[model samples]
Target: MRISSEEELSGVVRDATGPLCIRGGGTRDIGRPAPGAVIDVSGIAGIRIYEPGALTLVAGAGTPLAEVEAALAAEGQRLAFEPADWRGLLGTEGVPTLGGMVASNASGPRRVQAGACRDALLGVRFVDGAGAIVKNGGRVMKNVTGYDLARLLAGSWGTLGIMTEVSLKVLPAPEAAATLVMTGLDDAQALRAMTAALQSPFDVSGAAHGDIGTLIRVEGFSQSVAYRSGKLAQMLAPFGAVTVERDGESVAALWRDVRDLAPFRGTPGDVWRFSVKPSDAPALVDGLRRAGPVERVLYDWGGGLVWVETAPGRDLRPERLEGHATLMRASTETRARIAPFQPESAPVAAIAAGLRARFDPRGILNPGRMG
Candidate 1:
């Protein structure tokens, strides 16, 4: 259904009895199959409101992320919770939508400090499967209620309902930032270094590691960033020789590539996203190495987030990954044959099912996208 207006969208949903899938920018269009008509929410796109002082920004579901970022940049503020650029990994072109980012709960290296998308979401307005326009939470922080359903729907992969507008918490941009690059540490050593820095008194905003290098980022006032950089460098000294700083342009380029997963782009391989205990990352990477030829592995969120690209034609099975592994980018055959999500416990599965039923009774919204 082409919903040009929010009211019209709600009307269409209210009349539906079977199932309905919500479609936005279609970046993750292939992630799931729609069993019924798709409610193309992209048609209802625009920024409804933005208040810098209030640290709140609300936009239509289809508002492109690029536009939102540009606006926030002009105001010297930004979404405190960094979102990822999935287009690079998917090998697709087009700006991702704000709603899609919230739906996927996508985050970048900054997640280690700034937190995830769900954490920054203040409120949400969406159309449920019953075609009712429901508002949850609020524009301000601190909402006490029976359940925080807004967050519950944030990462539901459009399986729950159609998010029409979202109010997110924003923060002023950091005064300055710097990256400390340490070269030549294996996965295990890198993970240890990152974990240590995360636990330190210095406020390390971002930490990421790849096959060739490990990076630690400090963001704050110029003097503070400088002081923390020196302290973090000393702390990471045990790992190996380290490079103190990266120029602004170079730092921006590096993080852009990091957010885009540049090293894995255009590579003919299976990509997996794993979330495990920070301490478990080393063991998982080592297990992957023993299993087969792994091309590139990027660790983020202080080793909690693992992005791995397997060798061409090699089976990147969860069983071989040794820890929790979710296939984030994969071929159709691979996705169909393997589970894309970590196996949930029975109680968690039951809770997920109940939440699904509450927002999407007919299982029409991007069914199986998360599973």
Candidate 2:
């Protein structure tokens, strides 16, 4: 079912007899076999408002990410969170949409500095299971006291409800950028360097390490960027050979690849996204490598986001690792065999269940998509 208006969507949802798989751009709609109807929201697309001076944007849920980014670029502003375009990594040939980004809480390399999609999110309008339209949060960014359901919709994976419109806070794009590369450092040493850079006053915006090199990006005015990159290099000189790449094609390409996880795109393996502390990332990688062949790995977000590509069917839960891991990429058969999402604790599961019941008592939206 394709819906262009919230009223039509609500009526369809109200009269839905079975399960529903909500789709925005269909880029991430391959999770589970559809139990019943498929509501494609791509028809409901447009940019409702963009206030560059106020740093706010409101758009329909089906608005393509490319369109929004282009609009923001026109105003010399961009989504601070830097959401990832997962087509290459997921092997799905479709444009990404804002609704999908928010649902997944997707973030790219700049997430280390800006934050995930949820951080920029200010408000949302969604349809509950009973077909009622609910709105939360406000256009103006401010501290609010109460249950913030708009933020809750993010990363809920559409189990709660179907988002119709969204409002987000944006920021000005950096004027200049530079990356200091620390080459030839092993995982342990590289993580140490990343931690040092992140803990410093140099304001590292992006930190990622892999087969290429350990990179720490600094973005700002040309003078400030150059000075900070130099200071960061001096601070990290003890680790290994450090080189600087100024803002240009090379530096932009570097971050684009890191943000998109381009290295692991064509590799034949199951990809897992690990959220672990910087101090423990190396140990987790060590344990995983000992278990099976880890085809590729990229440590991003100051080693907090670990993207690992391992041999097919390899278990990603390393010993003594205290963090969540999600199967980001795998065949439908493989994903079904092993739960795609990380399991939650009993108490946490209960809380999630309560939220789901409150928002979607009929259990009609994106059934079984989380698994």
Candidate 3:
């Protein structure tokens, strides 16, 4: 089934007798496979409003992300959260949509500084399972008294509601950007260096460690980028000689690779993602190896986000880690046997169940995707 407008979507929900699997661009295929009739929302697309001066944009949820980015680029602005393109990682083929990005909360490396997709989200329009069209938030930022549905739905993965439209806060594109690279440092040393750089006053925009090397990103006016990148090199001297990539093309390509997990593309293993304390990253990587063979490890967001490629179908959750590990890629049988998302505690799970009951009383939207 396909819906082209808000009214059509609401009608479809009202008529659905069984589960409905919500699909956008089909780029992010995480979690357990949802069993239902596919409701394609790509028809509900187009930019509705864009105020470049105000740094805000409003668009239909199904609008192609590439179109939105092109519009933003023309005005010298961009999504502050730096959302990643997951097609390569998921091996799915389709243009990413704004709604899909919001549903999955597909944030990139810039999240360490700007925040997640939810932070950039100012408002949303969606349809609850009851066939009611609900709107929360607005184009501008302000405090609201009650449940912030805009945020609550951002990363809900379409279980509670189907988003129809979204409004986001944007940022001016940096006049210049550069990455400081350091080689020969192990994960521990890389984490220490990245932590120091992030904690410093240099306003580093990106920090990551992987097979390539340890990288620190700074962006601003040309002079500012030069000064900060040079200073970062000096500060990181103890780790290794830091090479600054000042050419814009090189800097962009490198960060895009990090943002998209380019290194993991086309690899032959199930993928896992972990969210742990920046300091705990190295230990967690070590623990993952002890549990089973891990093909590759990439650290991003100052080590707060860890991506792992390991043997297919092995449960790689570290026994005593402070954070959670999510299975990002696996066979259907493996996903059915192992929970993809972190198992929530009693209280949190109760709250989630209550929210779902309130929004999707019939339990017909994307059933079992989260589990």
Candidate 4:
């Protein structure tokens, strides 16, 4: 079923006879497959409002992400969270939509500095499982006292509610950008280099490592970017010779590869994402290599985010963990057996269950997609 308006969507959910798989652009098919009739929200899409002067924009949840980006580009602004496009990695052929970005809380390499998609989200309008229309937060950026359900709904994977529209805070696009590349470093050295670059006072914007090299991005006015990139190169000289890439297009292309895990694209293996302390990244990689047939690995967010490609159907969760591991991509059998999201602790699990019960009393919204 397809819905073109909030009232139409609410009515559909209220009258549903069985489970419903709420979908936007369908680019991100990461979570466990939900068994139900697909409710296509792509029809309820278009920009509702945009104020470049106030750095604010509001749009339908199903608005194509490209449309939003193009509109923002024309105004010299952008979604600072740098949302990633998972089509190549997930092997799903569909345009990414605004609702999907928020639902998944999708973020890219720049998250280390600018924060995630949820951080930029100002407010949202969604329909609860009981067919009640709910609106939370505000259209402008400000602090508020109370439960921030707008952010709570984010990264919820549509389990709590189905978002119909959203308001976001945006930022002006940088005047210039450059990346300092350091090659010939192992995971440990790369982590060290990334750490140093991030800790520096030069205001680095992105830090990532993969088969290519260790990358440190600095953005600002042309002169400021030049100075920072040069200083970053000198500071990181101890790791290896630093090669600075200043061409705007080249710098963007490099980060896009890192942001999207381009190296693992089209590979024949299951993909896993690990969120841990930057200090633990190298050791985690070492342990994983020792324990299994790991194929490829990439580090983002200053080594805090680990993307691993490994043999299919393998339960890669360690006996003890400081953070969490998620099964990002896998076969139907593998996803069915191994939980796609990290299992929550007893206390946390209870809280989540209670929230689901309260928001989705009928248990009909995108059931089991998170687990």
Give a tens-digit lDDT track for model 3, residues 264-354: 9998899999999999899899887887798999999999999999998898886566888889888889899999998888999999999
**By TM-score, how accurate is candidate 3?**
0.99
C-alpha lDDT of residue 185 in model 1: 90
Candidate 2 minimal-lDDT segment of 10 residues? 26-35
Expressed as tens digits, the lDDT of each residue in 311-356 for candidate 1 is 5445555464445666777776666666677777799899989988
Question: lDDT of model 2 at residue 303?
Answer: 93
Clashing pairs in 1: 13-131, 14-131
TM-score of each: 0.93, 0.97, 0.99, 0.99
The 0-to-1 C-alpha lDDT of every candidate, in the order given, reads 0.81, 0.87, 0.92, 0.92
Local lDDT at 101 for model 1 = 92
User: In model 2, which runs have C-alpha deviations exceeding 4 angstroms?
Assistant: 29-34, 143-145
Candidate 2, residue 300: lDDT: 93
* Span of 10 residues, lowest total lDDT, candidate 1: 312-321
Task: Give one digit per residue, the lDDT tens place, for model 4 in 1-371.
Answer: 88899999899888988888999998988778888989999998999999999899999999999999999999999999899998889888988998999999999988999999999999999999988999888877784646899899989999999999999999999999999988889999999999999999999899998897889999989999999998998999889999999999999999999988899889989999999999999999889999989999999999999999999899888878789999999998888889999999999999999999999988888898888
Q: Please give the lDDT score for candidate 4.
A: 0.92
Model 2 lDDT tens row, 139-233: 77794746798889999888898999999999999899999987889998988899999999999899999987999999988899989999998
Error of 2 at 66 (Å): 0.8
